[model samples]
Structures are given as structure tokens and as C-alpha cells.
Target: MTIKSGIICYIIGIASAIAQPNPDRPDLCQGAYFTEEEGAKALQTFASTYHDKASWEARASLIRKGIREGMQLPARPQFAPLKPIRHSLRTMDGYTVENVAFESLPGLFVTGNLYRPINATGKAAGILCPHGHAPNQDARFLEQAQQRCATLARMGAVVFVYDMLGYGDSKQCDHKISKALTLQALNGIRSLDFLTSLPEVDTTRIGVSGESGGGTQTFLLTALDSRVKVSVPVVMVSSYFFGGCVCESGMPIHKRPTHQASNVELAALAAPRPMLLISDGKDWTRHTPEVEFPYVQNIYGYYGAKDRVKNVHLPNEGHDYGPSKRAAAYRFLAEYLKLDLNRVLKDGKIDETPNKILTPTDLQVFTSEHPRPADAVVGDEAVLALLN
Candidate 1:
């Protein structure tokens, strides 16, 4: 087919896919809250409300409030004292990985691995690495996740790779249950607190990045928390698709009676602050360059930080946190967080070989021998009650 014909066929296929529902996975490209046309119009309407910095701040405040109310977030609780527990500390070529766990809520434990440079002297920059829904049923132990964290750490940033609710060691609740949006957002905030609490971490230099579903978490946290100085949400943010997963759009975040917003607006709330939107042609983000990027760039323009915002669209790549995606994020983070990129680069390319990808068992924070904490919330009901 000719390029023009190919583009036409792709649009026709998407329309057909939208018309037919897949019983096995109903939410795929569902665009439940708004159609592509409607979403585009909504973004335009939201952007129209902001002209100057003062107007943009007012709009941002309204959007943030809408998110909190729509997600049904409870009062911000004192981040339960980060009684962090560190298990295995494995030293790598230029960094080290510490198997770590901490409580985001009273009984809800957030688990993951913390990576740090071995030759650190004073305070260092910090990065939060949330993972996409990969390894299918399991979310951790992905080589890509490990490699990114390792590379960032070797380049002088303390990185934390955390589990998403039920994934990995955080098996207290099911991944698809209700209140996930609220719980995960809280966990992210607590994760930020944990990262910054470390005396070795500089408070001003902090960042968050993730792909796919994790990208949802990345922007959500960045939108809600000002502590996140830099953000790179990959293969996710789309003007059309709010997010297929419940965790991303399960709540009423996109639909308030008085106002409506999409992930694009949620992401744009990180305006003026440095952010990198990485999209690929194989997924919903295919139109990001033409659609989402311009909308967000206009928002940054309000603060005169348009140059600080960037969009790296890969027409040939698919919807995964592959090497190219990580490279874009690595360069952005290195520049924004002031990390030593030279340490992670060789021959003008990121060297992934330095990372020692550990097995899932090796990275788990709660195992049979170590056992989950006695106070850890046991089932979904119990965990949900904590939020209620």
C-alpha cells in the first residue's frame, strides 16, 4: 500500500476496533470517557483558559484540585515514619543495589530496589523509576528496569525502583481492585518522601520516569507533587486515550461535573518544570508529536519554559521502555538532574552491560525466609479499608 493509503487504512482500522468490543480485554483503546475528537476539543478548551502565568497557575490549581477530588484521595496523612528495611546490598561495577521496603500507609508496604553510586561523597540527585505492566502477571525483575536504575545510579543519582501495589513484593492487594488510583498515588508520594529523606539525597534534584502504565503513575505523581523536579512519562500520555487500565482512569479523574480533563492536561500541570514526553508509533501515543506535545508546549510557553519541555517520538518503536526510550530519558535526566552522564556513556552511547540484572527472587524484599511484616495488610478488603 502507498503511504497515504497506509495512513487511511490505519485510521479505518482504529475506528473499526473502537466499534467492536473485545470481551477478553474490553478497555483496550476504549477511550471510555471521550472519543478522540471530543478529547482533542477538551484539551483545546482547557488550554484556552490559560493565557498568562497567573491564569495558568489558577487553571493548574483547579486541575490539581479536580484530580484530588475525583480520585477520592483522603486527607494527606503524615507519611508513616519511613521505617525502611534494607536487605541484600549487591555492589556492581560503579553502583550498588539495595533490596528495600517501606510503608506508604500504616499496613501497606511498598517494596523495591534502591540503586546508588558506590563512590558518592556528599548529597546526590534522586530518581524514581516506576515500571510498566510487564512480565505480564509480575511487574518487577525486568532487565530494562534494572538497567535504567543502574545506569542512573552509576551516573550519580540515587534511584528507587518500586512495585505497583500488588506487583512484586506488594502482594497485599490485587492489582485491579478499586482504590488503586488513590493507593498508588499515595505510595508514590511516600516514595518521594523516602527518597528525599535520605541525608545523602539532595532535596532540589529529584525526578520520576516510567513507561506504559508506569507512565500513568509518573505523570500523576509529577502533577500532584511539586517535589518531582523532572519527569519523563514514556509511551503513555495521549490526548485521546486517558489510559486503558483502571489504575489510570478507574476513578472519576477525567470527568468532573463542572470540568473535564485528559492525561494531557494532567501532564501539562508539570508546566515550567522540566518534563520529557516519550511516545511511540505502535501505541496510543503515536499522535503525541502532532497532538499532545504541542498542547503541553503551549502550557510551558506560559512560564517561558517552553525550551525546557521536550518530546521524543519514535515512529519505528513500539510501546515498551526499550533502549532508545531509556536513552532519551537518560540524557534528559542527566541534563536536568545534573548527573555525570560520561560515566554511563561509551562511544557516544549508553552502555547497558554494566548493569547486573538480578532475578526476581534476588530482588524480592519479602520472601519466605524474611517473611512479610506481621502488620502488613493481608487481603484486598483489609487494604482497601485502610484507605477508607
Candidate 2:
């Protein structure tokens, strides 16, 4: 069943009232808070508030400020040097993969693999690949993640596939911290710092793509950072559904006493920039074509760049970054980032056969030989202390 359609039904089944936030609690918009009718009405109310570019930008500024303050982000966040550690270069079909780790904060390590073209000669586009809450913590090791990164590298873009907080080698603390949303956003910025630091990377041609929770990360990062030139968030944008995880909506980014927001508005913050929304019939994003897309397109209309924001809806597909989803992302990224899609095409079709799938052990960044830093903080409380 589609998420929004069943929200009230599910609540009734549990003998509970409709989902509503208690006034005493922080106004965190989670899961399906609105039915189709309510969501459309909310969009209408939002639209009526902003008539043109000037008003929309003013609203956008408030939304951005709400996000920063809600997340309790520092007025001036000090960034430490991303002391990177790299090794394990494995050459495959048209790309080379290297296991990498870098400090996003003092003693906090972000781990992943860096994929690059086998023989890159000039400035190439850089793509950041973040994963959702897949079965195992080792999301970057998943077949779909590997396939997309390798395919993009083969297409001549340097790709970095990194782990979310408690996933894979980023195990210094649990992923359920109160500040989970804040840390993940910071990690994304640092990932860009690391990606652009490469001598071969083109700073002007940066892009990001992911699915599910990763999709939430993709648009959130793109909205906050101007460096992201292209964004393809798969199966995660919804007007009624604010992400279910602490990492996505743990903070009060969507609601405060003075203002309110939704993922539809947040995603639209990528105004005039190239953004592709990938949705399916089985999840919260099922209403994309009707409910969300039109609202975002209207925002883009203010910039006279409505064509830049596009939606690819799959009525037959569910929520996953499978081959079909990857194909759509590939086409969009290539068109905007100037990547060579022909390299991954065979028989005039996208072929992912060239991407190598490796075991979790093979992609692990911390081992006995290359241990995690001794000074790394442990547990949720200790990590929170560092933020203070």
C-alpha cells in the first residue's frame, strides 16, 4: 500500500487517534502526517505566500535559517583538516577503486571507497554516493551502490561512496544520536571537501545521488551546499512524509514557532539548479507526479528554469536503487555533468556488467594493519561532548 493512503488506516488499526504532535513535544514532522487532500492544501497555502522570485527567495531564506537553527548548528563551525588515509587500489574494467577514510570532525572518521577512471587526463566531474538504511551496515558494499559508482566512474566521473554515521567503518558511535541529522549533514560537506581536493576533480561539475534514506541525504546536502551542481534523489521525496529516521528529522527542521516546512519545499531549494526526482508507486513518493512535482516546478518557474527540475516516476517499481533507477540517474548526471554515457552503453543499452561487486570484508576501511585512530571518541554521549 502507498504510505499516505494507509496512514490513517494504520493508525485506526492500532486503536490510536490520527497522528498529531503533542504541544509539549518538539514539533517533529515524521512519517505520513498528511493525507493527499491535506498535503495538496498545505502546498496551496505555501504557494499563496510566495508570488514571485523576491518573495520566494525570502521564504527560502527563512527555511534555510530554520534548518540551521533547528539542527543547533554552530554560527561558525570550525573545520579541521581532512587528514585522509587511502590504500587498496583495485583495477577493474574501466575504473580503479580505492578504500579510503577521512576525519570529518576531530576523531570522527567517515569511511568509503573512491572510484576513478582508469586513465583520467583532465578535470573530471566528481559524484558523491550515499546509501540508505539497507539490510547490513555496510551499505556502500551493496551491489546496487557498487554498480552505480563503478558505472559512473567508467563514464568518466570520479565517485566517492561513503558510509552514514553508524554504518560500515563509521562505527565510532551509534547512528541514533540526538544530533544524527547534524553530523550527517556535516559529513556530506566534508565529503565534498575531500572530493574536490583531488587534483583531477572539476569543482564546477559536482553531483550527488542516492536512494531511500540516501535520497533524503542527497537533496538535503544539495539544498544546503551550493557546490552541488546536479542532484538525483531516488524514491524519498514526499509532501506528507518527513523522513522516519533521527538522521533525517531528528531535529526541528520542518517546524518551529515562527515557520513550517516540508521536504517538497526543501527539495525545491535547489532552484534553477539541475535536479531529478525519481519516484515509484509503492512508497511515500507515489504522489510525486501530482502533488509534489507541480509545487516544486512552480518554485522553479520563478527563476524561469522550470525545465531544469524534472521528475521520473515509475508506476511499476517499488523503492530501491535497482538497475532502472540507476539508469535514470545516469542519464541525468551525464547530461548535466558532461560524463561519457557511451562508455557504459552496449548494444545501445545501459549495461552494468562491467561493475565489480565485492564482499563487505574486501571493502572494510579499518583492519588490524590500518586501525581506527586511537583518539576516536566512543559511544553517543562521548561524541556529543565533542560537539559541545
All models: lDDT?
0.83, 0.85
lDDT of 1 by residue, 37-135 (tens): 776887888877778889888877888998898878876664577899998889999999989999888988889999999988788999999877643
Which candidate ranks first by lDDT, i.e. highest?
2
Candidate 1: worst 10 consecutive residues by lDDT?
20-29
lDDT of 2 at 243: 73
Quote each prediction's TM-score.
0.91, 0.94
What is the total number of backbone clashes in candidate 1?
0
The TM-score obtained by model 2 is: 0.94
Report the lDDT tens digits of candidate 2 across residue range 1-388: 1244234322331231134433445688765656757777888888888899999999999998888888887766666689999988899999999999998778788899999998877899999999887544666787778999999999999999999999999998888788999989888989999999999999999999988778889988898899999999988888877776778877889897778888899999889899999998867788899999989998999999999999999988776787888898999999999999999999988999878888888888999888998978789998787678
Q: Native-vs-model 2 lDDT?
A: 0.85
Number of backbone clashes in candidate 2? 0
